[model samples]
Target chain A: MSIFINKQTRVLVQGITGKQGSFHTAQMLEYGTNIIAGVSPGKGGQNVEGVPVYDTVFAAIEEETVDASILFIPAPFARDAAFEALDAGVKLIVLIPEHIPLQDAMDIMAYAQKQNAVIVGPNTFGLVSSGSSKIGIMPNRYFVPGPVGIVSRSGTLCYEIVGHLTGNDIGTTTVVGLGGDRVVGLNFIDVLRRFEEDPETKTVILVGEIGGSSEEEAATFISSSMKKPVIAYLAGRSAPPGKRMGHAGAIIERGRGTFESKVKALNAAGVEVAGLPNEVPAMIKKILS
Target chain B: MKLYEYLGKKLFHRYDIPVPHSKIVESPEEAAEAAAELGDVVIKSQVLSGKRGKAGGIAFASNPGEARKEAERILNMRLNDLTVEKLLVEEKLQIEQELYLALTVDGALRCPVVLASLDGGMDVEEVAEGRMIKWPIDVSIGLQDYMTREICRRMGVSGALQKEFIKLLPKLYKMFRELDAELAEINPLALTPDGLVAADAKVTIDDDALYRHPQLPRVKEKTDLELKAEELDIAYVELDGNIAVMANGAGITMATLDMVQHYGGAAANFLDFGGGASVERTAQALELLLGTNPKVLLINIFGGITRCDIVAEGFVKVRESKGIDLPVSFRLVGTKEAEGRAILEKVGIKTFNSMDEAVRHAVDLTEAS
Candidate 1:
């Protein structure tokens, strides 16, 4: 029992003929994701790693049941691919492209909302439901079935933290990447709501970074409503203002989204904020004990 | 990519928004010549930063001679670390009223928002909430006629003035949409004796969207090392600290920096080579990090798609190519970690599996130094 995706969830791949698409498709298949069809515009009638390909998402959906769609299209073409999937009624979209235009991201988020769908990232590493299904680019060995639900904005940071957890004999139920862009699809609150409802998830770990009011907003939700204990680790405390720190959304603008503000919010909400990445697994152990 | 004032006005003028007649000048002679033609002009230093007025980057000249002096003074001035090299000499308008109009993305609303305030000529962030009207624009429908009319009415704008606003707002919204701008601002949309004119223009295009809008000017406001990092396609930001930090992801890199500070060590710079970084790219990133000449170097990599062995080989390659004497704390984990550690070991470089241990070691080295 996992949130968003599992072994029974049939998936579709957009831009499946591309280098990243083909590689990840094989990786997803290896991890036992139920991939049914692929979309590559002109590469219909072809197969990638035994999954059938179609010219369009509509064409692919016509033949196979695509519960979710993972896009490997580049940033410029990501919007169109996402729209194609949404128009075909694919509810869960994993957008795996970086440097997507901010306008395109806004439109994608708005359109996805209108269609009652959820998009994981436009600049993301996607999500994995730990031993059940892997839709993202995270290494499979780092994740195993466990009680902790992990949601994060940064991909590699999430992986590194997950490695700490798995290495310490802690497993996760699902790991969702919210993307490291100014505008992303699913945020901390969105994932936290799911984690709170999941019986398998007894504790939640939020991996947030500087920039944007998402973490502060998530803290508000957690304090008012959440029953399960949550731990948070925020990055970019040492970053200077007005400089973009790798991620487009990871900058402190106009004194908002600073590390102090986020840590204050999370702490005020009764969530333990880890000072270092390695401190997380120990904190989780204490909470569960 | 924040455009200079002159460039923003150029975009505004191209999109049919009304602006003061202006000529961009580089030298004091050109400023005098432009002022003579325009009459009673304002000499504005064309820079990417705001608060130009506070920085003494703006001056009014009643005559051409004054304009030349003002230009000469401004040209030598550095506003917010940016030297003023160009001036936008424009006709100073007789202002009847001032208003604020801007179209910017609202992260919370997840869409473009039009911010209108009758109280202008100051930072909108400082403006009282009640005085400002924020209308979130749905990207699907865009800025509609009704929305603009409502905004104008709320600001007590009517008659011919309302008509001017009705005509102007859409054009501004069009420029915002077409240019893929993060912010399109008119801080003082002055009601002049001639007509409504933009007193100042602030336009910032999305850096990610710059590839599509190649015609736009690229402002160089970065340090030499930052520019070099840009050319090498590595994410790097220099800080005034001792330990130089490098990692695989933006979050991890930032976290590495935070940890260095947490353990009472200041980080010299932030460098992330991004995921699946090739050995060559890794070597280049390492070389760039070393260029900072920090007291200690901390490399934290949790390879997922980015292999540990690849990153290790990059360290070995850099060590073989250029001799390194600095204390280096390298943490390698995930995907072929043993092989990566083995490669580093061959070069007498010790690798740690724990990020905390590696960061503490680096901080200790910096402190010891």
Candidate 2:
């Protein structure tokens, strides 16, 4: 079974009526997610793609048995939506907004943890639980049900890896995006631990990039307790120091954050590291074979 | 999402925390007036970004003439990549104890952390090595009484300042919450040799939360450059490159930039129509891209929300509409991808599906030129 999302996970869209919310909700419905309800302040009585909408998250929660909430709300209201979801005791929250204020993000993170709620992003594309359930905005065609569990920081890189794997007939169980924000809710280790315990997940593919000590922390976690064979790829190998390659979190300042350091750490920890995105599926195949 | 230092100080003043007496001036006339108000003032250029000191964004003026010159220099100049459109003239404080105080998001710990140090001004980051007073403020419950008390004890701000500091901490937290600020900082809280006073203040508000803030002008030119071309409407951040990129949607633009770097080519600029861009907007984009004077152009689009033919038509019209004639490369996918290609193919625009091929062609143009 997929860890965070599955067919059993009844979901609610916090911003069901907005342009992004409506589009993704329709996509999730097409992908077979149990979208139980939606919440928007003014458009409560309206329906979005056959799903009921409520004025408040608390109101929506009272009416439906939803396990998780996917927030497609804009950045400014991200904290409010997350807090509302947490107050309703949602087990998982998928936030698909970028450029959230650092203070608001920090508060939301603290609030989510206090309420025993786990959030996926403040700048993320969401997650796809193979063929079972989908949350966020990741392209679904790239995935197929398999033993490999994928966790990545980049949204499109996850798609790039899946494109590489899908062509080779390999698939993923659950692809989790920790988001490419500097201060995201979930980290690599957090998703990895969940992957480790899932019986359906025998192998893992991690799509990491240059920046932060996240990859190092993941390497340490894998070295200590992980049993699954994991093949991973870290982007920005050619990226020079003191250059930010678009994503705010992808910058390598001084000698602290670089592609080489991450690759070296993962290799030392027994993770079969793909030198590039194209090399990932082949490495995973070689290890599994 | 950053508010100016003066705004932060205004909030501080409302909270009863002492901030330096300051005035924000727009013109040279106003600059002189502000300096006169302060008497012995420090004329500081007010740009949004940091590293102002390095770029001559901060200067002192002894009199009105000097202040006007400094303001004139600052207003015309870019400081930390942001234009210094305004200057802050503040009554200089008597130097005494300088300390750093900030409440920010600590990524690793996954919490709201309060950082304070006895040292401030130059090299504060150096002194923040290991023993700085750090208070882990809870996000939902906010800064508890005990957390602030412990922070006060470590800061050595006890006695009369304890109650004042306690009141200030909550107010800071409140301001952070109410404004949706990313950072609320008071660096070198200059005590004027008197023991306590905030010399400088900084605030950064979240831009995404602007739905409620109607008066908040998007500082970037949300200009009516729209009539010119779709390319012009797109926010362009010029980079050191010969290959100009025109991409639909922000994410794809980012990917195109990465792919450009991967193929050993630097991106000229990042231009995005966001989503659902039209023909007029596309031509506008082309005109803007051509302004960079790049050797080649890469137009990457996955037309899910946008039509390929519409974008292609815009490129064709760029020469006629904006008088931009440039060698261009493109990769069009998703809706009407074939039709879009036919239009571009007839016009001699280079086309490729693989990002690898597109980047290679663009890099070749740069090398040949």
Candidate 3:
């Protein structure tokens, strides 16, 4: 069983009429995600890939049980879609829009907290719970059902690392992409806490990058409360300061959020950190053995 | 999207935030004219980067002649690899105190934050001396006057100064919101005989939110390579290393750079062909990376929204079109890996399933060459 989603998890698609929304909706259906309904403001009576569409999240929830909602709205309108999902009582919201205004991200964060909900990302690839269910854009073939839990700040980086693990016969219970935006909805600490509590997830693998203090914060939490053995792989060691490396959050500023700092913090917490993604599987095998 | 100092000050003036009268000048003669118009002015080199004062990009002029000389020297200065071509001539203020104030989003907190310090005109990172007071602003309610006063009190600000801070905080917060700025800072809000004035301005408009502000104060010029990358919708940054690294996602791209460096190879550039890029767009991304002329090219793609076969198609296209002879190594996994590898194999371009093998091979090639 996964921490957030599973086979029984009924999902709804927000902005389901848009190109990405429709495309991923079909993909999720193909993966057997229990998609209950869809939302696309004016396209209420229509259906996307056999999933019923409603005008608003509130209207969609009135008819079908939507435990989670995947938002494919544009960056400018992503905040409104998140609020709509929260107001409609959808507990888990996965935001797919990148380049969301910082102010809007902050508001979304505050509102999500107030509603006691989980918002994955404003620039994420979403999450998948291996063979049983998936709610994101990640290719399902790379993931297999197992005890290792993966949480990362990137999509392709997560894919690469998970592929290595799966190739080594290490499957994952769930893989979560926390997004690469500066102001993301959830941090490493939040996911780590959940992973620590999941009995099915025996060990955790954190895929981090340079930029924010989330990795440091996660390390702090692991040193204090985490009992599960965790392996970490941090990126951007050679990245120069003051230059944003692709991701808005992947920059070292004022000597803070450097690769050395993150590695030092993680190592201090007794978490074995790998220098590269491919080294993770061997380290994990060593830890398990 | 960092606004020049003169432009940032213009916005401060528009918002009724007190700032010295300033004029943008190109040459030393224009700077002298502007300095003469304003008495005993300061000539500041206009560059996109910060720490200008420490970099000698900021200088004071006692008179118009001195201003002209300062402009000549500053115009030829380079700070953080950016040449200063323009100068901001402004009337110098009689400062009684220099206070630090800024409004920016704290990524970890996931909220807007207001930072004020008694010590000013220095890097905020050096504010570990206990003079800095930070208050996280709730974006729902914004930076209220009460919150500003509370922050001022926490920063040991009192009397007329506290009142001025209370009045100024809202305007600064408004600028941060209305401009869609990622960072809005006044390094030294000087308190002088006239009033509280912004001694320096730094406003970085969110590149994604730039569409909202069409009539920006000035558009910072982009290099030809940067413009080309923008046209192709790929995140590209040119570096001074020997290995060209390309990946499908930002995190993976950065990790690839780090791995290349870890294996004793310096990456020449950082390029991420963001998710779901089409076959044609992927080809264009590869072509753009080829323009950097690195010793070795390393392509690591773990397809999610992006398809691995599409990336393979791009490699094939580049080889067929430009006929690349440089040492190239790639790792393809996830989303049609077999098909992607077959495409590469058909083109006689060997592919690796392991990122480590590919990175090590590329780094070894760079060393061998």
Candidate 4:
């Protein structure tokens, strides 16, 4: 069984009328995600991919149960959309937009915690329960239903690794994109905990990059608690110090989140860290065998 | 977007946080004039980087002539690769005690954290962790009065000084929240004979939130290529290497850079065209990559939302228009891979579906060159 989402999970699309929202809504629908309703303040009474749209999340939830909400709202309006979804009692939020204000992200996370909900990203590609459901903007072609549970911070990098895995006849139980924001909803440990509990997930593949203590923290969690074998592929080892390598969170700051530090931590935790993406599938094969 | 000391102080003053009397001057004459009016001034190089004090970017001036001389020396100085164009000429304060206070977002906690230290003026990072008291502020509740008081008490601060800190901490928190600041810092919250005065300010507003605060100056601490990339809406970082690397996502782009290095080649720069890049945008990104004039260009696209065909079309467009001179290694996969590969093939360019093969080829080309 997959974690977080499956075929029966009811999803709500926020800002459904927007370009990204409409496009991904069709993609998610095509992937057989149970999209119950859409929310676009003024564009109520419309249907996107045969799903009904409402003025507010409250109005949408009044008709059907929405287990999760995927937002495609712009950076500035993300806070209000997320708050509305939380207030409407939606437990899971998948924020797709990048460059969301740091303050808004913090406030959203704090609010989500208070409401007993989970947020996926402010700059994330969302998540997928392979073969069962898709709630993110990942190109559906690469993922397949299998034993490995994938958790990553980068969308394309995850897709790249998944492509290699799928090419080698391996599949995934679930792929969780934790986002590349400095302040995001869920982290490595949070997703790893779920991966550990999932019966279908025999092995966990962590796709980490340079930045933050998340990888190191994940390593600590894996060593102490995780029963499943974990393999990792960390990016940006060649990154220069003090330079933000594209992602807001992907930077070496105060010598804290260096590549060496993360690699050492993961190695100490007994996780085989792949030097390259293509090397991961073999590592996973060796462990599973 | 790290604001200069002068700008940070301006924001501090606006927020009613007590700061030393200061004037920003671009020239030595202006520095001398401001010092003559202010009396016993400190000429500080207005730069964005830290450790400027150690770089001789800071100097004390007891009189106008000394201020002018110091300003001249500083204005000509380059601290941390940044040229000192402006100087903050301010009245020097007699420090009774030095304390550190800052409000920054704690990534792990996903909340704003207030860090207070009795030891100040020196690097807070270098200070013992025991000396610094960190309190994570609940974003929903914000910075409470009791939290600040508790922090002061934990740091052994009491009496009139505690009261001043109690009043000042909230203002700093407020500034941090309202300005959408990533970090609002006072390195040396000095206690002078008069009262508590903020001797230094290092405020960095979130670049994402810059749109909301239009009044704040957009500091250009980037290279010309970086600035150009910003204008082109491409995420780019200049590096000191020979191979120019281009990729679709930030994570993958970094991985591509790592791969290049792993294969014994250094990347000239990091450029991410971002997701769902159109044919034109891809062509533009190619042009920007070419502008770096690297020995080789490595284009790695794990096409998901970003279509391989579109990226291929961009390559063809650039090849047809400007004519690419340097060797290019293209790795195309994911959606419409065949179509993208065919497009590149029609233009007499072969593509590698495997990232390893493509990266190795790029590195080999760089070595051969």
Query: Which of the numbered candidates is closest to the native, going by highest TM-score?
Result: 4
Which digits, one per residue and each the tens of the lDDT, describe model 4 over residues B1-369? 999999999999999999999899999999999999999998899888889889899999999999999999998877888888999999999999998999998999999999999999998879898999999999888888899789989999889988898789999999999999999999999999988899999999999989998888888899898998898879999999999989999999999989998889999999999999999999999898888889998999888888989999988889889999889898998889999999888878989979899999999998898
* Candidate with the greatest DockQ versus the true structure: 4
Native contact recovery (fnat) for each candidate is 0.89, 0.30, 0.88, 0.91
Candidate 2 segments exceeding 4 Å error: A14-19, A36-64, A74-84, A97-107, A180-183, A208-216, A227-276, B1-11, B22-89, B109-111, B161-164, B214-235, B247-255, B272-287, B302-324, B334-350
lDDT string for model 3 (B1-369, tens) is: 888888889999888899998889999999889988999898888888777888899899988899889999988877767888889898989999888989888988888888888888878877775678889987877778889788877887789888888778889899899888889999888999877899999888888887678888646467678779977778888888988888888988888888888788889999998988888998898888888788898998877777888888878888898988899998887788899999999978898878889999999998899
Alpha carbon deviation, residue B11, candidate 1 (Å): 0.4
lDDT value for model 4:
0.92
In order of listing, the candidates' clash counts read 0, 14, 0, 0
Candidate 1 lDDT tens digits, B71-90: 99999988888888889999
Q: Candidate 4's fnat? A: 0.91
Model 1 has a DockQ score of 0.85
Candidate 3: pairs in clash: none
Question: How far in Å is the alpha carbon of A162 misplaced in model 1?
Answer: 1.6
Q: Local distance difference test, per candidate?
A: 0.91, 0.76, 0.88, 0.92
Clashing pairs in 4: none
Docking class of 2: acceptable
